[model samples]
Structures are given as structure tokens and as C-alpha cells.
Target: MSRTKTRFAFVCQSCGFRSPKWLGRCPGCEEWNTFAEESERVISGGSSARPAVPYPEIEDLSLSRIDSGIGELNRVLGGGIVPGSIILLGGEPGIGKSTLVLQAAEELSRQGLQVLYLAGEESAQQIKIRGDRLGLAGKHLFLASETCLERFLEEAQKIRPNLLVIDSIQTVYTESLDSIAGSISQVRECAARLLRFAKGERVPAFLVGHITKDGALAGPKALEHIVDTVLYFEGERHQNHKIVRAVKNRFGPANELGIFEMTGQGLKEVDSPSQLFLTERAPQAPGSAVVGAIEGSRPMLVEVQALVSQSNYITARRESNGFDRNRLSLLLAMLERRAGLHLLGTDVYVNVAGGLALSEPAVDLAVVAAVVSSFRNQPLSAKTVLFGEVGLAGEIRAVSLAVTRIREALAMGFKSVVLPANNLPLAEGVPKVELVGMSSVLDFMEWAG
Candidate 1:
């Protein structure tokens, strides 16, 4: 009998880069003090060749999705949950990731679907307390406090649940790995095993993932690639509204947004998120501009607020919340060069109201409007909504779904819409609203004045 030799290697926790020796800084992610030692077992044996199998024939099988009984969650998932798919849900601590999943599990159980929830982070009693508080019956919802991947799989096979949920994949470990739980090797192996089980059993599984301090998912980047969908739950802890944004999906459309309100009962779906976002807007305030934004298939109206002030430091500070900083810099340069806005020696701060992050280019005009409005101390029309892409030459470019955005603005009781000149013809048929089209940013400034 030959003994197996063991080898140890240092792994970067951020990117899963492996090295023979430990280092102060990881070469893969350039993160300091992220390398940790992990053990690997090498078995001494001759290479064995395996026969390759032919490709399987494709079948015209219809895959029916399971309704989670949560409209907001379903929207983010691009519909209901698909069978035999693995979904990864990540969020910051105390941002209601576990609460959202628990509510979904209860809803599925109420629909007579067997759901096995493996609690790796909390005890069964703790989950029960939360479930009971959330008014869950738990009739078909099975709870198991297990952390070992192999044992969980064995139990799952015996019960044969329709859905499986691991309350955080960080705590789950495999016996084959010598590294502790939550390590790079452990997370990778455990997720791979779970993926196989989900595919083989044709059971839809949900894996709750932990996010690092920097807000990225805390594991190897490959972990996200192995999953079928990745949903990010985002919101401030102090805020009442929570946003679930889909960053990746294999069965549905990516970049879908789901809105929910955190309440004492549980998370309740917000049907009209636009109204919720603009409920407390100061209509008469300067530096505030309303933008008609489209999130996924849903159209919404959001407020963009900006503040410009004299710089007290040597270099002016440029800051943005819920918006890209680099993009803000580009817009500032455009304002200075094309729009003749002297913002070079001033501090500029931009924020998308209601904790919602806007990334689409349609919001460029609104951001520029808000910044200029603040700089000139002029208040924009409260009932006027803006949506268009601002070019480097100060041109207002047309955006997609112009009619959709116009309809949403109309529904929100906005009287007039300031849009790109090219979209005016497309939206001319939209009645009961005035369309103010601008060919350039300079034209918009003159109109505003």
C-alpha cells in the first residue's frame, strides 16, 4: 500500500490565486493580506484514461417554472424560478437576504411544493423564531441544521425535495477538503458538488452568498460563473425600500430590478416603486430633476439631486452616490467645455434619490440638468421629467423605449417631458403631455432659463 502525500499552497481569498508560499499581497487581486494557506491531497497513481461518451440527443422538453408567490422576486428572476437551476443570492449583512429567502420558501411551501432549507449559519430554532414571526406555517417547509455538504446531500436525496436552499454557502463544507469552511477551496468544492446535485435531481436550488467588505461576493470569481443566476439584494440598512437587481441570469434576462419594502411583518412587494421613491421629494428645491428611467421591462420615474459648492481645498471634490464617479467626471468635463459651466474650481456632488442606482445612459440629461440647476441656483419644473443621452458635443441623443418612458411620466402625472429632439416625432402621438425636445444641452439651458 502506498501512502498519499499532502501539499500545502497559499490561496488568495479574493480571486482564488494559488501560490506555493504565503505573501503579504496577492498578485491576482492585488489585495493585501488576502493569502491563506490551504492543504491539498495528492494521490500517487498512474494516469487512467476514461472513454468519452457521445453527445446526448436534444429533447423538446418544456420546463415549467415554479412561482415563488412573490411578484417582486419573480420579476427579478425574469419570471418564476426555473427547475433544475441554481440561483445565487448575495447581499450585505442585515440587508434582508435571509428574510427574503425565508419568505419565498414559505410561499413555495404554501403552494404544496416541498422545500428543504438547510440552515448552515443559524440554528433550527433561530430559523423557527423568524419563520413564526413572519407568520409562516411551515407545513411543507423542511428545516435542517446541517453544514456538511455530503450529509446534506444524503438527507436531501432521502427526502427528495422539490426545492433546496442553503442559507449561506459560506458555512457549508465538504469532507474532501482540509481547508476550513468559507475558504476559497471549500466554497469552490461545495458549490460544485451542490451544482451537480441540482442538475442531477432536477431540483431548483437557491444558494445564499456572503458579500465581502468591499461589496463583492466573498468567494472565488468562478463561484458566480458556476451558478445559473446571480441576484444581488441592495439597499441601505436604514432604508425601508429594498432593491433586488439581477446581475446575471441564464434562464432569464439580466439587469432586472425588483422592489420591495421591509416591514415588521416581512418584505412586502412594492407595485408602484416610482411613487414610493418620489413620495418625499421637495418639488420646489433646486438641484432636483426628475428622470423617467426604465428598469428591465418596467418603467419608473426617479429623482436626481446634485449640489455644487465652492471648494475649500486645493482640488475640488467630485462625489456621487448611487451613480458612477468616473461618469460624473466625464459629464463635468462636457459641461465645462460644451455647456460653458465653470465647475472646475467648485465641488460637485450628485445623488440618485431613494437609494436607487441608475446606470442607463438615458439618465445623462437628468444628471446634467441637476448639476447645472444647482450651479446656477435655479429650480427646474417639478412636473417636468428628463430622459436623454448627453453627448460630448453637448448633443441630446435619443434613448430606447422613448414611448415607454413618456407613458410612465404621463402616468406619474407629469405634464411635460424634456426629451431628445429625435424622440419628439416618436412621442408626438402621446396625448395630454407636452414634449420639450432639445437638440443640444445649450438649447436645454436656454429653455430652462
Candidate 2:
């Protein structure tokens, strides 16, 4: 008789980094105490080889997508859900990941499509209650409350549904692996199996994934790579607005965003996100500036607010919300060096009106204007909008879609715009909006004063 062998390894909970011995910190994500030990059974068996087949000639098969009856969702999914594509949807707990999936499934079922919902985290009764509350009474929509991957796959094959949705991937477990559900091994193995199933059956699948404390997908990082598309549901749980953006999409463009407002019935699509973001604006408020920003091809007018005051401590504190802190520091330094705002002893704080995060450099000029307006206690015109990229050398740089931004601001009843000089030619065709082109940060400060 031969003794069976076992192999032991450590896996990082943060990034799935594997190591033979435990280390004080994970080299992958530089986190401490995140490693978990796991054992692998070494089986004694002869490996079977697969038979080879002749390669068939490639043919042109254009993409075929299914609409979920939700226009905003279809936009984020690049028109619609692609056949056989596995989509991983992740977000903070209670951030509406489950709600959005349920809504989409219900809509698809209404369109005469058979939808199979595999609920691992919730019971069938709970799901039915939610569906009832959402007014979902589709006979074609089927539900199965199970955590075993094998059982779910069997039921899926038996039903042969047009679409499949796993309420969550983190809760599912497979009997073949000894690891518990949500473990690194279990997550990776289950995701791979589901991807294979979706591809073999040519059915689009949506998997809800749990998020970690740091707001990343709570599992092996490889789980994100195995899926065809990755979508992130973001927004404050207490807030009414929720944003869905595609971080990775093999079939369509990345960074595409879809906006929604949470309501009693379910998630409602926001037709005009820009207007919703600026609905509570105060008139003629000092330190408030409107920025014409383009988020995923949609032009938006978002309010940027700044506060500048004497620092109580020796070192001035620079804080930001919905904006980058380090970028704020650089912009402040530029303000002192070039614009001569004398902000060295001032504590600066910047915030976007809504919970929307602004990353595009086009809003740089707006931040500067807001800070200056706050420090001087002067209010910018309520009808004026500003957008331009500010450089370290204090020069203003042109941004893309200048005409689109101007038109969106003008349509929103804004009359004036401060833009980069180089982008003036692009917006010259627009007559209703007054475009003021500035070459440098100093020029903008002088004009505002």
C-alpha cells in the first residue's frame, strides 16, 4: 500500500498571491495578515489525454446581443448583452447589485425570454418577495435556491433558459474542491466552470460578486480575468443615485457608464444625470463653479465647490471629495506659484456637488476658479461655466469634445463659458454661448477678478 501525499500552500486574501511559506505581509498588495493556508490532495492516477480534432475554417459571425428592456443598462453593456458572455457585477454590499440584476432579469422575462436565477445567498421565498415588490410576475422567470455549482449547472441544462443569473458568485461552492465557499480556490474553480458553461451553451450569464473592505472584488483577482466583462455598481448606499460602469469589456468600449436613481419600486433610469446632479445648486454662492464635464461621451454640468480658510495648525490640510487629493495638491501649488493666490497657509477643501467622481483634467480650471473665488470671497456668475486642463507651467490646455461640452452647458441655460484658447475654434460654431478663451491660469484669474 502506498501512502497518499498532500501539498500545502498559503494564499493571500487580498490579491490571491500564493506562497509556500507564510510571510508577514503580502508582496502582491502589500497587506498584512491576509494569508490563509490550504491543502491540496495529490491523487495517484494515470492522466487521460484528449483526442485531437481538425481545425475548422474561420467564419464571420457578427456579434448578437439581447436587450434587457432597460435602455440605460443596454447602453452600459454596449447596446445589449452578448450571447455566451459572462459578466461579473461587483459592488459594495447594499449598493444595489442584487436589485439591478433582479430588475434586468424580470425585464428579460417579460420580453418572452426564459430566465433562470440561481440564488445562493438568499432563499427562494426572499427572492419571490422582492420580485413581488418590484412587480415582477413573469411566468418564464425561474428561481433555484442552491449553493452547489454542480446542482446549479444540472438545473440550468435541464431548463435550457435563454439567460442565467447567479445571485452571487462568492456564495457558491463545489464539492470537488475541499475549500469552503468564498475561498480563493473555490471562487477561481467555480468561476472557470461557469464561464465554460456559458460558452458551451451560448447563453449569457450574469454573476454578482462580493466586494472587499477596500472596495475591490472579494476573491482571487483571477476571477475578474476569467469573465468576459466586469461591471462595477458604485454610489453611496444612502444616496439615491447609483452609477454602473464597465471596467473591462472584451466586446465593447471600456469606461462606459450608466446612471440610475434608487426608488421604492426599484432602480429608475436617470435620463438626464447632469440635471439631477445640479438640482440643489445655490445661486450666486462664493466658491461654487460649474464645470462642463464629459463622462463616457455624455456631456454634464457638475458643480464644483471649494473652501479656503486660515489653517488652525502649522501645516495646512488639503482635503477633497469626489476628486483626487494629490491632484488637488498639485493644482494648489500651481495656484501659488503661477496664479499668485497665496494659498500656502490656507486649508483647502474641494467637493463635487453630487457623489460623482471627476477624474478628467478638463475640470482643472473649474477647481482653480472655485478655490480662488472662495479665498477672495467673490462669487462667479451663476450662469457661467468653466472647463479646461491646467498644466504645471500655469498654461491652459485644450480638451476633447469642447463643442459638446459647450452645447450641453448652453442647453442647461448657462450663458458664459471659460475654455482653453486652443479649443475656442472648436466652439466657435456655437452662437448662443459666450466662450471666453484663456491662455494661462493668470489670464483666468485676471478675468475672474
Candidate 3:
């Protein structure tokens, strides 16, 4: 019996849900108009099957790492890049994803290692122009502008470089799949093949991915799962600072972040991110408060600014930047109910300084303080820092890594810290710092007053 050459199905772009027929809404993610027809080849007679190989002994296997020579990138990758690992780098366009990878490739080439960079989106001349502008013309660095997955893989095999980078996986397509490049089927298959090649050939690979309108990776969800590490480049395009954060890592810790400052030369690592974040902070400004946040194992100080004013419209406006909108709403409600603040006819705006997104519960106290401060038009002491979780019942809660937060704050010359009363005992080492412990939101309001 002969097998069909191709089969088709509707796949949801948002959730990677596969269905035989098209639907108005995806049952998985509930996203509308996200399903697209994808075609895959049907193989017969097991002709393309790989012969089974014996598993290696656990004690005999060894893992080696390569340093990308960029300290910021290395730290986010958990010390160094592991050989045979597939790293998925995703970000918004113009957020320095390509610049970062190209810089790392140049650094790797400088370490006497060959690097194969496949630029599927840009032409060879364009890449050369960028390389020349960035002063990254390395003898060992090889570039090829190809979108065909099979040919790219063939060239990779021929080069046998230490590091392989696909400028973007979305732009690379396979001949076996009838779908065009950037489609779900093509991205999944191309990534699968590259992952196999990386592991089988023991060459580290980096796959650049584009994000969707919803800010998720543009390809199928399987693309993130198949890779060993998923790194996100986050920052505003107009802003000079950028952050590379690791969301998932099989070999190391997740949520690790690396800070960089984009310059005319290239991405420069920020050694003192806390200082950089607070460099331009107005010391005696109302609605501004400093909070220490821990990203992975690193602790840093961030400024939280809020504005509370009379609402012009019937429904009060609530806006937040670099902070959760829902959380801001919750805090506003708590300020009214628990702190005895009259916020009914007010428009509130909150922003985290330096384009830093803070999700830690410890920042709750800071947010409340900033909002309340703005309402009262009182300026918090610039020498003070605060961090704690606020409960719905108006009680302040202790946060993890209290000791680390205090140490960082004190090192930055902040003499006073407002934390949960229960966490006062965690401040054992720092006797020189004054700690004002608050047990509830009511007490915090009084203290701020």
C-alpha cells in the first residue's frame, strides 16, 4: 500500500492545539482566528527511522561548557553555555536580540572557537555591514544567509563550528513541510531538526524567535519545551537599557536576569544595576519610594512611583507600567478599605523606574507606600527603603530573602528600611541599619503620615 505524501490539520497558533477541522475559537487558549491549516509529510515503510543506539553509562558521560565571553549573557545562561544545548532566544523586534547574539558569536570566535551563524532574515551583506559597525569581523566567524533548513543543516555539518546560531527559527523552513516559513508546522519541524542536530553533533545552538501580538513566542508552544533554555530579551526599543532573563533552564536556575546598556559600540554589561536604576531618582519627590527586589539570586534596589489625583471622568482611571494592573487595583482597594484612604474619585498611575518589571510580592508595600504618598503629597525619606507583602486583610507579611534585601539597601546608603514586623529578626547582620517594622497597612499609613 502506498502512503500519502502529505496530511493537513488545523493547529492553534496560540496554544498549539491540533484539530481536524477549523473552529472559531481555540478550545485550549480561547483565542479567536488563531487556528491555521498546517501540512505534514506522511512517511511509509519506516524508511527514515534512525537505528537505535545504546544509552551511554551515566558515570562515563561528561558535560562541557563554553563561555560566551559576555558576562551579562553568561550569567543569564547560568554561568556558561553547555555543549549540545538548544537555547531559544525570544523577544520583541528591535529589542537587541540579533545584536546580542552577534556580539556573543564574535566573542566566542575571539576565544579561538569557530562559530556558524545562519542569518535567515537578513542578507550576507547586511550582516557584514552590522558586523563591521560592531567591530565583529572575526576570522573564525562564518555567516550564511539561508532559510532552507536542510541546506542550513548541511552547511552546519560542513563547518562543524563550536557554536551555531539561527538568526531566527521562524524564518527557516523545511522542504518536507508544505507550510511556509514562520508557520506553526514549519517552526516546529525546523526546531525539532535543529535540536536533534545539536544534541547528536554536540554543538551548542541558539535559535532566535519572534514574539506574537500577545507577547508570546510566535511559534508553537512545543518550541519552548523542546529547547534546553529559554531566554527573553526585554526592554523598550527607545530605551538604552535591556534585560536578558532566563525563564526556563534545565541545567541551571531560572528567573536569572542580566542587565545591559545598549551603546553605539554594542551591548555593555551593567555591573551595578541597582545604582543604574536609581541614578536619576529624585530624592525628595512625592509619590516615589525605593524597594529592594531579588531577581533570581541577585538583589537590587528599584524605585516605585505612583500618582493619585482627582478623576475627571465618572470611572476613575487606573494605570500601571512595569507592574501588574490587577495587583494595582487590589492595592488601591486595600488602601481605601484597610488604610482608611479616600480613593474613590481618584485617578492613580504607577510606574517602576528603569523599565524594570517587578512581580515580587515584597514590592506590594512599596506600591502601597508610593500610592499613599502621592495621595497625601508627602515625600518619603530618600534614605529609606522598604519591602514586604501586603495581605488582603491589611496585614503586612514577611517576604523571603529579607536579609539579602536589607544588605543591598544598606550598601546603597539607605539607612532605614520598612519591612514586615515578623522579618525584623532576619536582619541580624545589619545592626547599623534602622528597621521600621509594620504589622499592618494601617500602621504603614500612620508611619508614612
Model 3 C-alpha lDDT versus the unseen true structure: 0.88
Q: Candidate 2, residues 190-212: lDDT per residue as tens digits?
A: 88889989987888899898785
TM-score of 2: 0.93
lDDT leader: 1
lDDT of 1 at 2: 40
Candidate 3 lDDT trough over 10 residues, lowest sum: 55-64
What is the lDDT of every predicted structure here?
0.89, 0.86, 0.88
Number of colliding residue pairs in each model:
0, 0, 0
* Most accurate candidate by TM-score: 1
Q: TM-scores for all candidates?
A: 0.95, 0.93, 0.94
Report residue 256 deviation for candidate 2 (angstroms): 1.2
Task: Please give the distance, in angstroms, between residue 94's alpha carbon in candidate 1 and its true position after superposition.
Answer: 0.8
Better of 1 and 3 by TM-score: 1
Candidate 3, residues 1-449, lDDT tens digits: the string is 54658899998877678999999898988888989998888655644667776777332212467889999898888888888889999888888888999999999998999999889889988888888888986779998888898998899889899999998998999888888888877888888889989988989999998875365545834587989999987656778899888989987899999999989888999998899889989979999999989987799999999999999989999999989999999989988998779999999999999888888899999999999899999998889999999988899999999999998998999999999999988776687899999999998888887
Report how far residue 443 has shifted in candidate 1, in Å. 0.8
Find the 10 residues in a row with the least total lDDT in model 1: 54-63
